[model samples]
Target: MKFADYYEIMQTIARYGHALDAGTAPFDQIFTDNVELDLTHAGPPGQPGPVIKGRQHVLEAMTGSADDPHTYRSVLTRPALSHHTTNSEIVADRGDEVEVRSKFLRLGNSQPGPMPILIGQYLDTLIRTIDGWRISRREVISHGP
Candidate 1:
């Protein structure tokens, strides 16, 4: 792929953050039907843990968890410490698909609490379907409590 297209792909990957800024649902739309998030890699969030599958499942994870006062407020708006910060791995082509990995980090803090740092990677598999480049798989690995 040319440099321009490569940049475009990276931008699309980063766009997930932009949409999260404007969206109430954090990551549902960012993932595809076949996508699955293995949050166990970072342990669970207790009841209604955020590990989810498919776009709808991920959507519910974001929306449903927002019922808790703490979680709701934490996510209703973007965390103060986190913005759109990401570093992408070299994009590799796999026939009609592209394999991409990116390191993501964000910071968040709450009243009467210590400011926490969040870091993660988006392991993505994008495919060039009839609709053009679309995320076919996504795995989120986070380093945070």
Candidate 2:
């Protein structure tokens, strides 16, 4: 019900997005000690899947170099894809903590013949710690059929 709180949440979301966009692992300041992420991503085994429990686990699932040899070799993994969030709907509120549902799109990756275009929504639970607001649990739902 407060504009300041709304702005803070928005900023927090933007920071997370920027971290991923810059292809850098998000610092520990944005996690709730036990951050959980259910990523609907793949990268040919020993590379990707659902990572829960720690932010480090999520980082391994996401962090990579655009100039990496393997990525450069893979036709499907080239050209790259970026994610954008929209239609954020705040579903639950607990004072400084809340849960939001939003639609996300993986835009513009031309490589990977059959791009696993991610067009889906996420249910993210966020909390405000002593540092700031952080993602507590985020459940991903990828579209199919």
Best-fitting candidate, measured by lDDT? 2
Please write out the lDDT profile of model 2 over residues 17-44, one tens digit for every residue: 5555554444465556678887644323
What is the lDDT of every predicted structure here? 0.59, 0.62
Q: lDDT score, residue 114, model 2?
A: 39
* Inter-residue clash pairs, candidate 1: none
Off by over 4 Å in 1: 24-29, 44-51, 65-83, 110-116
Off by over 4 Å in 2: 40-51, 64-78, 111-116
Q: How far is 103's C-alpha from truth in model 2 (Å)?
A: 0.5
lDDT of 1 by residue, 1-145 (tens): 7675576567668766566554543342345556676565544355233556676655456445533212233243454645454778757786667888888765567786635466767788876655445566766676664
Which 10-residue span in candidate 1 carries the lowest summed lDDT?
Answer: 66-75
Question: What are the TM-scores, per candidate, against the unseen true structure?
Answer: 0.68, 0.72
